[model samples]
Target: MSSVSVNIASKVQLVLRVALILVIFGWILDIPGYFGKYYYTEQLLALVAGLAATITLTDPRWGRTPARATISLVLGLTVFIAFGYVSVRYPSLQLELASAPPGAVALGLLMVLGILEAARRQTGIFLPLLLLALVLFSMFIGPKLPDGFQTRELSFSRLSVYLALDTNALFSKILDIAAITVAPFIVFGFLLNAFGGSAVFSDLAAKLVGKYTGGPAKVSVVGSAAFGMVSGSAVANVVAVGSVSIPMMARAGYARHVAAAIEAVASTGGQLVPPIMGASAFLMAELLEMPYRDVALAAILPSLLFYAALMLAVDFEARRLKIGGTSDRLELPAQNSDAPDKHRWRYLIPVGILIYLLFFANRTAGSAGLWSAISIIAVHLIGPPAQIWHRLQDVWKGLLQSAAAISDIIILASAAGLIIGVLNLTGIAFQITLQMLAISGGDVGIMLLLTAGLSILLGLGMPTVGVYVLLATLAAPALIELGIQPIAAHMYVLYFGMVSMITPPIAIASFAAATVAAVSPWRTSFASLKVGAGVYLVPVAFVTQPELLLDGTLLETATALTRTLMGIGLLTLAAIGHMSRPIPLPVRIIAGLLAVANVLPVSALPQLGMAAVAACSLAILAWAAVPARTTPSLKHENT
Candidate 1:
């Protein structure tokens, strides 16, 4: 594989590198686009970028496998031509779309096959093949499908053309979002990586937290979470900080799986951490047409609460297993070594400008991201590096990474379009929700539980934007039908969907960590479940009590935040079986129950009713931890 990578670096990667650069360069607007149409060129370039980068990233000897390269190249061409050919000629495209001409149908079917193949290569065959099966099922057996799943006989000819040309299907606005909006953030992340941001965060974490009990593990959590919020991709986050933190934890006497799980859970949690909780948040802001700041602020408390629970879990487990702190002999990397510390101060400029643009300047996220990218290049070129030539190369590299990142997301966007098509075609979204409500007997608990479960499962297999789009279009409507607030409903789905990266079956973050640590993927994912327990609960709390989401009066919101943080503490203690000392099983149960109770939506009086249980549980745990005279003397003598 390493030899293959070497081969790829020298050969087949050039075409993709050029495509990404061209696509990113086109964003600047000065370049005359392809054959008089820049839009076609851009879209084509974006498509080419995905294929080229995927090939380059995976196959070291990118061109060595002629079969893989040929297939990828062919698929790339199909997607570019299919979408570009139609979108540019949107009218004739619509005609083809409306009537489903055989030529167009043949084209669309071929395009779908290409996308499936491309997706299979990027993330493996599961998602692409599964989604393809669903598409096929919709086409063949749909009319004859059983109840709850039946649809009219899909006209293969018409459907193909419709799906191909209609913006609502394969080449939809979601794809546009991927191109215009999501691409820039990906660029920002690439630039951050090209510089020293990931390493900076990790070292900063270790400098800050690497000396306490279980310090390396804690640093892994803190650093990964901090970087995850910035990177937005679980796989990237794990690969970035886990490269440093995972090994650190293993060296600190933590088992490989446990260490990997810590990094994976924390890194995955970063997707939910605010002010920019994943790229999906940007999409949410656009979907709701809300200010990005408001969305970031809305995500603030929930992110903190989730991290609080994780931190507490790490702490308790550290105590339970007597995991020691970082050894003083551990070495620290120089903050700015080969990179030179001269521009160290200038590093703050781009980040500062980005923050200002988002919070005070009131720019659209797309505009803010564009300016931020510009600032990064500008500052590095003028202020610090002085090596204009080297920084230029950095810019080119960042552009390629940015473009390569687009492929997975574009497929997700296209898949989302198909998902939307399915829902609109069958009106199944509402029906499914109605059925869920009916199954739950209209009880909020059952309703929320089911909705959240679906969100997580969907989230596990999908990207942030895809997951939210799927759930928002499906489960959210039912919650709204039950009178949930719109923002609350969206946030509920968003949170669960984001956490899915760490959830089992398709836990991207865990798998990513396993790759870095050389651990069993399943063990890493399952262990992540322990640290990420609050991910399962936080979404429920926010939905049930919007106050926890800061939707009400300051006093109420403050109170809710406090209670929720406390609940996180209690839950963490219970889950890790440690509170000052090992908690007895019954007491652990009691604390957990109280924690769960505290999170439930309750009227004012009902809230107070649960206080007794919490207060009593705390008292009993404290009492139990009080060492008896005889036992205390024997324990001291033994020590």
Candidate 2:
């Protein structure tokens, strides 16, 4: 390609990125509605799709080879034309769906193809292949399959039109949630980070815990949790916090794999934290038709249990390896030394406004996010005049970054919407649900195991939002049918889906951290499994004890909380093979069993389980208090 052409492509890409952001902001502010007109959801979706297609094709991250660039440019332009036609004709096409014109059907096919290609570029072949298989099955392959697995057939044009233009498919509620609800939050996160809120979070976490044993690891936990409130991405959280914390841990005598694992596990839990969780949480709120606050509130206990267990695990691992505190803490790269104390209010005020609006003022999540972003800008404007130009540049960069991030999410959501459309149109989701129930013999425990396995399996190599959408469609209904609370059921699948980021063979977050820590990815993954064990078990706890989700009576909630906490504490100790010193194998086994018994809802002998848990807790405490016969050399202990 000529330099002129390349420069033109880049400029076009920039324009598309800016336009995408403006369109979303326009929707949020009801700019069109204020002008005595409104965007049809389909039209808005078409525009987003068109802009995303162009921006992604021009994005150098995917590839920049001349041949690839030429192909992408041609394909992108074709998609732009197709989407443009659809956006203009969608209102009339809706009325003609049963007998759509040949031109519309051809354009619909182009639109679907373009979206699948964009999805492939962003997420890899797995999701796009899955979507293609579903489409092929719905159109041609289903009638040949065996009973129960087979789907109803549709013509190619009809299927193409439905997938591309129907509100349920490419332009779905899932996409709506992504575009309107999740995008603003993404903008808020980017802007906050740009304005140094992330540094504030990390510094605060360090000041609070960096003097303790395994302080860097603990700092990772607290810092990741605080940053996770806004990031809501496992890999993003790891990259942002782990870049600093992982090296800090290594310098403090932690193994590379251990440091990577700590960072990975801590970051993955961000998806489960309240206020602004992963994009899937907003989908959950919409799917359940519940307030977003309810979802956040229900998530509080499980998230706390997860982090608490993680905190203990790291502390015990540090003791076992005899790693000492870093009294002279590692200097954070992003920390501002000039006015660290003065800028604290800037971070706090926007976050305070966000929380107040979401929980107390009863505002929409989108509105809350917009107000929060506005507050951050307002705060930045009031800062030192010398920094104003630099901060304004940061805001612009954040807007572009947010547009790129949201484009990928929009593509994934569109693909997920196709999956949902196929299931609903062909009745496969119902059949699969029934088959799952039959395979489990109608037992809730068996059903949960099946669901968890499937959720993890489906989640491999997929982002959390995509994983949650797939499981929510395929696995959640079966769990819900087994007499579980709806929120608990959804939360169960979400946890397992999110955990796949740290599970072996495809632990994306852990592997990313390993790259930074220069350790074996496999070792980091297994270590993460050990460190984040509670995340695996806590979902089952919540499913069985609705009290964990704040859905039960006060007494029931307290009792469940106590048992679950003890269970998590015991489990952490067993996994680490230490209390104050190395636990004997037999004692570890006993503690593990007691942990299981306590965590599981033993409805028939609930009191017995509590008694056993209490006994185990007392025994562990007593053992820890007893002095070691010979103090081991702390400096020489092997990692």
Candidate 3:
């Protein structure tokens, strides 16, 4: 492309991004309602999808070569035309029933292909490849499969039209959640960070734990958790928090890979934290048809246990490696150099208002996010006059970044809708459920394990929202059918889906952190797995004993919480191979086994047996905390 064309494309891209943000914010704030010209959900979704696709294709980053640029521009234009046609004709198309017009059908095919390509450009090839495989199977191979797996075959045109135009396919509830509920929060997080909220979180975390052993790693955990409250992406969290924390940890005596792993695990757990979790949590509330607050409330104990386990593992590892606390006190970075004490309130007040709006005032998540974003702006405006222009520039950058981030999510959600549509159209969802049941042989444990594995597998190289959508569609049903509670089954998949961020063979988040730490990605990934081991088992505990999700009476909930925390602490000890002193391999094995036994469902054994198991686990833990007789222990190790 020539310089003139490049300038034109850049201008167009800017316009598209601004328009995308305005459209989403308009819908969120009901500006259309005020104007007496409300857009139907499908029409609005089509518009958003069109804008996202066009933006993705015209992005300079994706157009590295002339040929690729030409191809992307052509596809971008084609998608714009198709989505515009659908947006204008959606109402009439809805009335067409089984027969779509030839133009709609042709455009639908174009739209589907364009979306898949856009997704490939934005994310990676795995998701698009999987969606393509499913499309081909639905179109050709469905009826040829074995009796248990077969479904009525769909034609190419019919399938394409349905996926592109149907309410449940490309423009589904998942897309709605992404555009309306998630986009605002993404913007809120970006704005919060841009206005020094990240600095506030880091400074607060450092103050709280920087003098202790493994202080930098602990800061990563606390800061990431605070940042995760508003962030929806683990990789984003890693980049934002780990950029500061990783180097801090390395300076504080942690190995580069260990520092990266700590940041990766800490960042990934942010999605599991409450107030505001990942995009999937919003989708979960919608899927389960419960209030978002209820979902957050239920997530409390499990998220806490996850962080507790991570903190314990960090402490144990610090002791084992003989890493000590920083001698000098930590200070806020340069961007937040002005009156660092006051910077803390910039984040605290907005977050407090967000919590109040969500939990106390009964506001929708999107509304809470909008108000929180406004509060962030208000806080920044109140800062020193000389810095206002710089901060506003940061806010503008955040707006564009949020739009870009949201576009990626929009693509993923649309692709997910395509998958869900294929399943529903081919009647394969029921077949898969039956196949899972048959494979499990009516065993709930086996079914849970199968689901967990599949969740992790599908999650590789995918975002949490995309991972959860796949599992929720393909696996959660089977677990629910196996008599698991609806919330438990959904939360189970959500938890396992998150583990992939730290799991090897992909571990996208870990790899991102490794880049910052200048370490081997593989080493960082495996170390992250060790630090975040609790994530793998906590889901099981919640699934088996719902009290961990706060679904039981007070006593039952307390008992489950206490037992699971103990189990997590013991599991961390085993994984780290240290306590007061280095534990022998046999003792580590025993601790691991006892951790599992402690977290087993109360109903799995009689009351007396459960009590005995808990007692034994506690006794063993107490014994492990004592200093070894043969080896001299550092005083810090005994803390």
TM-score of each: 0.88, 0.95, 0.95
Q: List, residue by residue over 1-639, the lDDT tens digit for candidate 2.
A: 556557767877788889999998888888998889965888988888888877787765443566766777788878888888778877887888778668768877888888888888887888878877877777777777888677787777787778888898889999999988898898888777766767777777778888888887888788888787787888888887787889888888888899999999998999988889889999999999999999999999999988988998888888887776665333333322343555655777888899999999999998898888888877766767897777677777878888888888888898888878878877777778888989999999899989988887887789989989988888899888878989999999888989989998889999999988888999999999888776677998899899999988999999888878877877887787875677888877887787777767757466766676688676775785364688668776753
Q: After superposition, which runs of candidate 3 have C-alpha atoms over 4 Å from their true positions? A: 327-343, 384-388, 631-639
lDDT of every predicted structure (CA atoms): 0.69, 0.82, 0.83
Q: Which has the greatest lDDT? A: 3
Ranking by lDDT: 3, 2, 1
Candidate 3 structure quality by residue, lDDT tens digits, 143-220: 998887889788777887888988889999999999988888888887776656666666777788877878777877
Alpha carbon lDDT at 285, candidate 1: 74
Which has the higher TM-score value, candidate number 1 or candidate number 3? Answer: 3
Candidate 1 structure lDDT: 0.69
State each candidate's clash count: 6, 0, 0
Model 2 Cα shift for residue 68 (angstroms): 2.1
